[model samples]
Target: MNGKQKQSYKYDKHKQRLFIIPARITSNVNNDILVIDRIYDDDDGRVVVLDREGQVKWTYQGNPQVNSGDKLFNPTDIVITSVGHVIVSDVNNHALHVLSGEGDVLTCKVMEDQGIIFPMSLDIDTKGQLWVGCHSGDDQRKDAKLHVIKMSF
Candidate 1:
């Protein structure tokens, strides 16, 4: 078998829209594909989850209670934990959003309170610690930080 497009999902929950811009995608153990769709130039976006059949399972448009105004959901990267939970990087909001495998918004972990900002990338360690690769938002300083956080939920 050569290179061939299996299925293209432009819009979630059906129709083709191509609304996803610069998408970051990953698959969980359940064969569900998680995509981080950066929609706007301002880094505003949402996470779209689809099944193996290329059908939209559910869409999480950010938790309204936690995200609004300047602090909207701007997901840049995504990863599925060992337990099948989804962790999304909200760089602009300096936070990480944890979603259930079914696309339910579980918790919003605000990293700013713990002195972490611009959480760009994520990975889970062998010991189950979430490693966050971050970059300083300051234009003048091109610095980076790595944080390991152990979470339970």
Candidate 2:
């Protein structure tokens, strides 16, 4: 197949809900488009989910309780589970956000205490194990690590 651009979407940043610095874009098993939008250079990010028709389904802007004080959402990667649930990595906060297919906040798993300093990317293997790519403290580039966890829906 020839590599060619098939479709594109554009939105005015000031007029509508626009995509600001989209880091990663993917689709779920149900064909729902998921995007990690970085509002700033590396902070204040959100997850924008869209339907196959390019219609805005829902958006997640980080849980308020988790980003209250000095912490920012800082989403870096996104993945959808086999059951269509969404998983997002919050590098700034060192946590993985699990959400329902309809965009409800199911739970937040903080892995900082477990030595996962900066969770950057996520994926679910065929066996349904959750794979997390993360970075350690000061020397993130040199000390990056990948962890696999057995997760059940």
Model 2 scores a TM of 0.89
Model 2: colliding residue pairs: none
In candidate 2, stretches whose alpha carbon ends up further than 4 angstroms from where it belongs are 12-17
Q: Each model's C-alpha lDDT?
A: 0.83, 0.83
All candidates: TM-score: 0.89, 0.89
lDDT of 1 by residue, 31-117 (tens): 888787777666689887778877778888787766887777888788888999999988988888898899887888787989889
- What would the TM-score be for candidate 1 when compared with the true structure? 0.89
Q: CA RMSD for every model? A: 1.9, 2.3
Which ten-residue region of model 1 has the weakest summed lDDT?
Answer: 11-20
> Candidate 2, residues 14-127: lDDT per residue as tens digits?
347558788899998778788888886577888988776667788998888787677888898888887888899999888889999999999988888878778887888889
Local lDDT at 2 for model 2: 88
Against the hidden true structure, what lDDT does model 1 obtain? 0.83
